[model samples]
Target: MRIATWNVNSVRQRLDHLLGYLGAVAPDVLCLQELKCTDDSFPRQEIEAAGYHCNVHGQKGFNGVAILSRRPVEATAGLPGEPEDTQARFIEARVPDGGGEILVASIYLPNGNPVGTDKYPYKLRFMDRLAAHARQRLAEGATLVLAGDYNVIPDRRDAADPEAWVHDALFLPETRERYRTLVSLGLTDALRATTDHAGVYSFWDYQAGAWQRNKGIRIDHLLLSSRAADRLVDVTIDKDMRAAEKPSDHVPVRIDLR
Candidate 1:
């Protein structure tokens, strides 16, 4: 099966790009983040017409996420251990693959800009909650694929100019340490597992000619649980999507599993 994740930025604004991606890539399962719309306002009709079942967890104008699968899915909204957190940033689903099923999550982790503010703490707390949840799920022996825009630069090599992001929330030492803690829990970063090559990136800024200079970062990712990692075949960043008209700053990252 092929699974892919993309932030899209805003689903309404990039509907055409999304449709084109769906037609071209045709992943068995697709996890989407930053939908920027309500569930009722989601373009379900258009997506369904394209032959995917939609499971959306959406907010009005900020964070939102969804799962689209070629096969029917059973979905759960919201990340566990955060009943007070109302942001629609997470959605998990059970997708059938052959005779078994895999758990897939669409996650738009907090960007946590302006490091001194409350946002950074919230981002760290969210990571803690996510790690706890992942621990429980893995203990249960679930084959899991946590795919999305993590809003993290896991390593210096992930960024074109690492110094430029030294003061940024995404590249701070605390942030990367928490990311490493999560990965230490037996999750294989699909791309790094495939290749150690630098300069491979999944996102570029829309301003300052970032894409033109190849100043990009590999933040969008698919982290697989040990059982799921065992089936991993290939991983690709759909870099061309960044060059499309009205393109999202982020592109898709896809993984193939046997």
Candidate 2:
């Protein structure tokens, strides 16, 4: 099966780009983040016509996530251990794969900008909650794929100019340490597992000719549980998507599993 993740930025704003991608790439499962619309307002009809079943956990204007699968899915909304957190940032689905099933999550982890504010702490708390949930699920021996825009630059190699992000929330030492803690739980970062090559990125800012200069970062990810990782075949970053008209700053990261 082929699974892909993309932070479309805003589903409505990039509907055309999305439809084109669906038709061309046709992943078996697609996880989406930053939908920026309520569930009822999701463009369900258009997506359904493109041959995917939608499971959306959405908020009005800020954070939202969804899972789109070619096959039907049983979905769960919200991250466990955070009942008070109302942001629509996490959604999971159990998607059928051959005779078995794999758990897939669409996550839009908090950006946590302006490090001194409450947002940074909230982001760390959210990471803790996610790690706990993932640990539990892995202990249950589930085949899992946690795919989305993690809003993290896991390593210096992940960014074009690492020094430029030294003071940024996404690249702060604490942030990367927490990310390492999560990975230490035995999740395989699909891309790094495939290649150690630097300068491969999944996002480029739309400002200052960033894309033109190839100043990009590999923030979007698909981290796989051992069971799923055992079957991993390939990982691809669809960088061309960033060049499309009205493009999202992010591109799709896809993985193939046998």
Candidate 3:
């Protein structure tokens, strides 16, 4: 089965791009981040009409997620964390792949910019919660795909110039360590695992001629559990999508499982 993740930036602003991607990619399952709209305002009809089921975890105008599957899915909204946490940044669903089912989640991990603020602490705490949950799920022996815009550059090779991002929240030492801790729990970074090439990136800034210079980073990732990794066929980052009209700063990443 083919599973994909993409941070559309804003679903409302990229409906056409979404449709075009669905038509072109035809992935069995698609996990999306940053829907940037309420559930009621989501273009469910449009997506559903295209023959996919849409399970949305949405906030008013920030941090939202959705999972779309060509097959019937059992969906659960929200990441398991602080009960008072209201950010709509995670959504999980089970989609059938032949005789078995794969658990897929879309996550828009907090960007955690300007490290001195409350946001940075919140971001770190969220990673703690996510790591705990991931560890538990991995122990349960599920074939899983925790896919999304992680808002992290896992290694120096993931960025065009590592030095340029050292002060950024996404590349901070603590943040990378947290990400490493999460992946250390038997989760495979699908794209990196499949390809050893450097300079492959999934996000480019909308400002400062970043894309034009190929100055981008690989923050969007598809992390697969051991069971899922065993079936890994390949992975790809749709970098060309970023060059399309009115693109998101991010692009799509896909994984194929046998």
lDDT of 1: 0.94
Instruction: At residue 218, give the lDDT of candidate 3.
Output: 93
After superposing candidate 1 on the true structure, give the runs of residues whose Cα lies further than 4 Å from its correct spot. Answer: none
Q: Write the per-residue lDDT of candidate 3 for residues 180-215, one digit (tens) a residue.
A: 999999999998788888899999999899999999
Better of 1 and 3 by lDDT: 1
TM-scores, all models, native as reference: 0.99, 0.99, 0.98
Off by over 4 Å in 3: none
- Superposition error at 29 for model 1 (Å): 0.6
Error of 2 at 223 (Å): 0.6
Q: Model 2, stretches more than 4 Å misplaced?
A: none
Q: What is each predicted model's overall lDDT from 0 to 1?
A: 0.94, 0.94, 0.91
Candidate 1 pairs with clashing backbones: none
